[model samples]
Target: MATRQLLLRRAAAAAAAPRGRRGYGSTAEYLHRSIVPTMHYQRSLPRLPIPKLEDTIRRYLNAQKPLLNDDQFRKTEELAHRFEKGIGRQLHEQLVAQDNQNKHTSYITGPWFEMYLKAREPVVLNFNAFMSFHPDPKSEYNDQLIRATNMTVSAIRFMKTFRAGYLEPEVFHLNPKKSDTELFKKLIRFVPSSLSWFGAYMVNAYPLDMSQYFRLFNSTRLPKLNGDELYTDEKAKHLLVLRNGNFYVFDVIDRDGNMLKPSEIQAHLKYILSDNSPVPAFPLGYLSSENRDTWALLRKNLLDNGNEEALQKVDSAIFCLSLDDFPVKNLVHLSHTMLHGDGANRWYDKSFNLIITKDGTAGINFEHSWGDGVAVLRFLNEVFKDSIGEPAVSPLSQPASVDSSRAVQKLDFTLNDALKAGITKAKQNFDTTVETLTVDMIQFQKGGKDLLKQKKVSPDAVAQLAFQMAFLRQYNQTVATYESCSTAAFKHGRTEAIRPASIHTKKCSEAFVKEPSKHSTEELQKMIVECSKYHGCLTKEAAMGQGFDRHLFGLRYLALSKAEDLPATKRASSNRGGDLCQSKAKLLKRAGTPA
Candidate 1:
């Protein structure tokens, strides 16, 4: 009891500090201000432009050249030229026409969503991604219950701020002192919402599209036979908690739409934490890790068994807070735990799962179809700043004197024989799938971002070069590599692929790996500089929506949609022609390589 009192006192002291002074002081102050509305720049952001067909063809050929032999390249080039002058030109025109009709959103948005939702594979490691939080500096604050409570309060605060249009606008500041300052905020706040993007632009700042922000809360990916659907319900005020494979929910918002007091929230989370329920015989969460079609059928069976209310509660809640029972043993273990877990305690369909381990290590595993990392990263930065700076629940805070057992409801499903069998199969499948996967880490302690900045080279480009060198040293060959670059400066933008493998990288890797003594130091250095310059150019092109991948994707999608309308010969020729061309090019390249 004395220990408990001391803890509470410490928490209170931590909570009393001004919210912006704890961590990232200057950033916190810049981001938490409500001067610019969250969606103020949405109307003025540019649309993702459709690259010209000839330009896309040129970029595609360049990207493929590094992986192809001379003969193979010529053949692939011929096919590309044929496509460009014939069916590809028609597809490009149609795609542009379609884009013209859909002026409100980017050309890539619908197709990208479709690409994800139509995939039948399980989402665990395939479609979902995890980003772990750095642990709190205060050892006492890392207590599971205290961390959960504080994170919950901070999340609610973010939601309230965002919905009220006060959440800081997502911006890339070219000149922080000039653009991310009080004077800039004061001037920008008076600009009309529609023109606020231009106003920011004038100050050397670019505001990003926040259209995906709405799905950050109260959203879930509902599986279907053909394709999945994204569902969001902002009115839901409940918080879902998964513990020991059991599902529990309680209201975290009051009738007035305000978040519950920190003490009250802590009380309810503590109640859930203290409940010693045994892991279920057939944990329903495992089903969410199954293939989309399989999960869809099982979900139908569940609904037929009169579990609609239970499923709805799971889906409509404002994000999931997974209370893991085991401590993270190491970095690899923590990554695996947060990425997929045992598949029994994870609701993989949720927009994002806020997973907290028994030792209070926390991270988020988010569903990818509804949004991208940009939106999630912003939420993470804000939540981390808020919780660390102005934690609502500290170790010294006491739980409210309320009967939490009555407030929290444990959701129970009426599972039949088929559902139980399905759950067993899903668990086995998940285990088998994860068993084949591996995660490894390497640290370059000698140099990092600061050193790279001092060297005047792109950090990401150098990192890509390292990967190319490593692969060449291991396999004596270079392979096509992909790096994602966000196109979020445009309205409803998605990601564009930045092809990291280039002829320059290939030459540089060869110089370093084939025979170090043969090349002069200056020659190797020049090769590295060339690779970095080309990589930087690729990165810029992709960010500005001039990359070839999306353009080719759009063209192919249009081709498939209009397949039946085309002449039989054209349709047959267009069907996987590009893929066949690339495959044969790779085969020929391999044949030409020395053993």
Candidate 2:
């Protein structure tokens, strides 16, 4: 009785102890961890602040100045001021009140999601973004089956670590030797989850919001009329594989929620890769690339035709992995293949697709509505590191002896005449769309990050400047340019637009393009430095969530919601076309101008 009591007491104490004190045991640690859990900073992370209306107005005008002439600027300034003093103030207050009531998330979260969901354009090139991975150093590891197996095992490991909250928290370490040290981790483990962010902050490290990490696995963007929806099924344990326009699914995780053996997974993937299934005459994957509304309609048809189970399998899989049969000839070919492949062998609706070509060129093409590149890039970095450092499958590793033909299940759709025709139309539409797009690459071997750092200029700023100069030289005029800056440091934060076409850029571009011989090297260098400094400032402001775009967007959205409550005259004036003309006429009449 005494021995049993002692063992029980020890078990209870271990359970009560912090996760950092507990043993990770046999699980492979892909990422180094602090003492705190991955989501320890989520509750304490600051909310995205709504910029003051005046500050927003100032920033808006500053961003607009370079793009407009004197007359255009004057008219824009008048309209901006009028709106700010009128309905904008009320809308801003309302937005603030709304933001206050919803303290758990940023004010822009819902509207930002709505913006993406409500867009009518196809997701292929419009909404999905792709990033290619640099090939593995060993040529043998680049074999399609070997690479796919390794990535699959690595992906499941990531999902397990992330779901169990064992993965390292995403943090920007300004001073790594101090903040990223074991001493920092030991001290931080004592801090409460609520106050953990402050602890990290004191050490000059900023932890990013990990809310989007949930959508990184078992998530899909579902098509709907008017607006789409994001669906995630955390309970699903299957892995969806697309090859030669065919769909195959196999359990990567067992019923006990433990990952399947690496050998078993490799066998299943190898079986699917070897399966010489003929491509579907009307490949239904193309439907995902169609307009959202059309796809929604066709999706209903698919359900009616008894494809709900198959569709659900596709949607609920951990993530889609595509195995391409053809090799990419060059970087452009790789880009084209990864971006919007033949469309038959790709499922564009999944949160992300891990695509591997015949030459083992791998990249991720992800749907945009669920999350930003921050989450995807983190996953990519971790997976790349983990797969390379301790790969579950190697060149010499052989598949399990078990019959994988029984383990992997091929999904088939029951297509009606209408469904078949819809798919055909979708294929044609996808082809037409992709044909209009072109992929090009340029390798600037002369100077890159190291060179720019040596010159004490931001590499990104230099790249942006190059684009501005190239455009000016080509088109003989500067155009509005946008660069995305992430606001992921705040809870549920999205992104802010950084207007890169500043006055500094204009002057520098002109100096380089319009009259290069007229300016001395030192003078031109000074102008470039000025552009870089201003660009850096813009980037910082946008990342800090002080940009004007989202603020103005919120105000406009609020105003539209309250449009009916406005006075009849104001409502009429706020609209476009005839009402705008009538409002202008009334203003002219008030000013004693001829009607």
Candidate 3:
């Protein structure tokens, strides 16, 4: 029935947008009301004033321009657009500070732990909430207050440390222990609402040591940023092209400013990268899991020296297994260096990271969940240009979109809901189709049969198709049909809407069975493109110009359909569903849908 419906009715495209969605008014009205509700305070964080911050950044850039004298350091305006739109130095705390608050940590809100516990289940990405961070700093609360404050401060501090070009460990390592009794207490009191299955601390946190930091000799001085310096201006022009050079990313943490182990961070990264967003079999809070051994170590390290040392020790320059340091990075050190943990993220508040392996081998994982990849790359190129140390050949320009208030809508639906639905839909769709083809950054342009002939087709499309269809085909032998796993994938590794629809049990049913019939590659491509266009266009149309707010949208639809919510004049309409299903079957037949 689900497959028949997909083949006949274009869910998104065919539906005309209803009236009164956000941003339907004049652009001014949209901007006026659209400013994310959180930024009202940041409209005035006095320290590191905009002009002063800009002046400092400009000066810093001037100093590094000579390093890249060989390469023409052209700060193009177009580059800025890309940065603001998708790439740029992003300050997570600013945003987090606005809305990171929420209900206090307890058993009721345990679902929130999904923020850092993405290791349990594979998640289907949803690009719809382009840059959706969890409840802002104010959305909910627990120990996040102190942690988030420190996170923001640490980010700024990190920039300063970077500009200074060095860090010396201020704290040393310390060991801490937790018992099973604590775990029981957590499970009894604070299991997540969404995933009530896990026990406590499925993964453990180990100790952090101080011997892992670096020291600069009397010779070369590296350029970093200042703790007092703001990465951008009040106007946010720096978001355009990183305001000169050097990419920056800030983590939005708890108010208590608790930091996770490097191994945990790496594990977190990989877990997010994997599609099966599994949840821990254990409870996730501090008291929940037995995995807090590393907490004491982190506390001592940061307590003694500050996050400055913590920044340098992030398994970047040194190989942890060989070097023997704090924050074990076994998770990211792939069996071979061909690591695929590039773009996975757990969107809780504004804690973004840039995991870049220097030279893709230097062990330095560069990540920019805030600025993300594209912006990080531009910053890296700028830094490389700056390393050569040359004056700018061209002037810097304005950023792409200073105000992200409405570039994408803040849908009410959670990533979990999207994951559940997307996987199911994609799988069913795949089973109904003959094949799929995808194009991405990995250009398969080699003409020689020696290389090209060896491969059957591009790996990306193959993976997307296999993952989607296979997941659905394996999930449901009977019902749970939602066969379209639409994921929100960012371009150039940046944030974008991904809503992969698969049959729920999104990835269990054998939804990808090859049809008895076959279609040529050209015909398949047209079908896929049309489907993609339908997805991109209809999403907007349904939300009016303002876009779908998942929470609001879901609530409204559910309310209308709920029997209790029906009007007094309205009695139940029996067999309405059966009629619709019958109509759908007829429509698919008319449309020449394959069995």
Residue by residue across 1-595, what tens digits does model 2's lDDT show?
6543232223222211122212222365234433667898888887888999888877777877777789877866776676567666777788999999999999999888887888878999988989988888888898888888888888887788877777777776656799887788788877898898888877667777889889988999999999999999999999999999999999988888888888888889889888988999989789999999999999999998899999999999999999999898999998898899999999999999999999889999999999988888878876776677677788899888988888899999999999989999999999999999977888989889999889999888999999999998998887777777777878898887788888899999999999999999999999989989998778767777877878777765565466566444354444433353244233222211101
Instruction: Report the C-alpha lDDT of model 3 over 1-595, residue by residue, as the tens digit.
Output: 6542232223222111111112221221011122211111111211110112222223223322322232322432222223223211132122223223421221111211222132211111211012111222322211222222222222323323322322211111111143123353344234342222122112221111111011100011111111010021111111000001111222212234333222222222222222232332211111101112232232233334444432232212111111101222333233112121211111111112212221122111221112223222222332222212221111221223222332211111112433334334434432333123221333346454343224433333333444555544675232211122111110011111222232221222122244313655565544444434433433332212111122112222222344253242133335423333232222222211111
lDDT of 1 by residue, 56-108 (tens): 87998897788889987897788777777776777788899999999989888
- In the predicted model 2, the residue pairs found to clash are none
Write down the TM-score of every candidate. 0.90, 0.91, 0.26
Lowest summed lDDT over 10 consecutive residues: which window, candidate 1?
12-21
**Against the unseen true structure, what C-alpha lDDT does each candidate score?**
0.82, 0.81, 0.23
Model 2 Cα displacement at 181 (Å)? 2.3
* TM-score attained by model 2: 0.91
Model 2, which residues run further than 4 Å from truth?
1-34, 566-595
RMSD of each: 9.2, 9.3, 27.3
Best lDDT among the predictions, by candidate number: 1
lDDT at residue 341 of model 2 (Cα atoms): 96
